[model samples]
Target: MLTGKQKRFLRAEAHHLNPIFQVGKGGVNDALIKHIKEAIEVRELMKIRILDNCEEDKHEVAEALAKGARAELVQLIGLTVVLYKESRDNKRIELPKSK
Candidate 1:
């Protein structure tokens, strides 16, 4: 779980990054979750864009992706969902300490 401040910081860190993945008509799947888990482990923070044609609701998609990938749901703004997870080997981001 992330603190409010941590989420805000992550949101800012992710602002300039373009969405690295897209959820289209297929929505969230096991394959997508596997890829996301691998990518998040390397990058830590990432954005996923939900296409307008997607059948699942944006919030539902975000929740599913976060749960499936075991990553924090940093932010869901418009159609873009930001996710964060501490990397095991390629760690980079330094989140604020929770008090």
Candidate 2:
């Protein structure tokens, strides 16, 4: 679990990033999860966009993606969801200490 400060730091880091993936009407699936896992392993932080045509709720989609990818859900604003995970081989982000 991420602390409040950690989440805020991640959100700021992700602010300028463009959505690397988009959830469409088909919703979350194994293929999408697989790709997300692979991407997050390298990037540590990533953003996903929820399309207007997506059938599931934005919160549901965000949860599913975060759970599927084993990443932290940093933020879900508007139609975008930010995710973060500590990369084992390619670690990048340094999260703030939890008090």
Candidate 3:
């Protein structure tokens, strides 16, 4: 779990990043989850965009992706969702220490 400061820090770090994945009408699936897990292992932080054509709610899509990839949901603004996870082998981000 991330503290408030940690989440804020992550959100700021992710501000300039582009969404690497898009969730469309098909919604979340096993293949998407698998790919997300692999990507998150390397990127640590990533953004996913929920397209206008998507059938599910943005919040639900964000939750599913975060849960599926076992990553923290940092922020969901507009159509984009930011996620973070401590990489096991390819760790990069250094989160702020909790108080």
Candidate 4:
């Protein structure tokens, strides 16, 4: 679990990033989860865009993606979802100390 401060910091850090992936009409799948898990291991922070064609609820998709990737869901604004995870080999983006 991430502390509130850590999430805020990550949100700021991800503000300028573009969505690297998109969830469309197909919705979340194992392949998507696998890719996200693999990517998060290196990038630590990323954003995913949910397109208007998607059938699932935005929140459900966000939860599924976060759970599947074993990452923290930092924020879900508009149609974008921000995710964060501690990189195992290529660690970056030092988070704020949790109180």
TM-score, per-candidate, Cα-based: 0.97, 0.98, 0.97, 0.97
After superposition on all CA atoms, how large is the RMSD of candidate 3? 0.6
Candidate 1: which stretches are off by over 4 Å? none
lDDT of 4 by residue, 69-89 (tens): 989999999999999999989
Quote the lDDT for 30 in model 4. 99
Which residue runs of candidate 4 sit more than 4 Å off their true CA positions?
Answer: none
Q: Write the per-residue lDDT of candidate 1 for residues 1-99, one digit (tens) a residue.
A: 899999999999999999989999999999999999999999999999999999999999999999999999999999999999999999899999988
- Misplaced by over 4 Å in model 2 are none
Superposition error at 13 for model 4 (Å): 0.2
**Clash pairs for candidate 2:** none
Better of 3 and 4 by lDDT: 4
For 14-98, candidate 2 gives per-residue lDDT tens digits of 9999999999999999999999999999999999999999999999999999999999999999999999999999988898889
Count of clashing pairs, candidate 4: 0
Local lDDT at 19 for model 1: 90
lDDT of 3 by residue, 17-97 (tens): 999999999999999999999999999999999999999999999999999999999999999999999999997889888
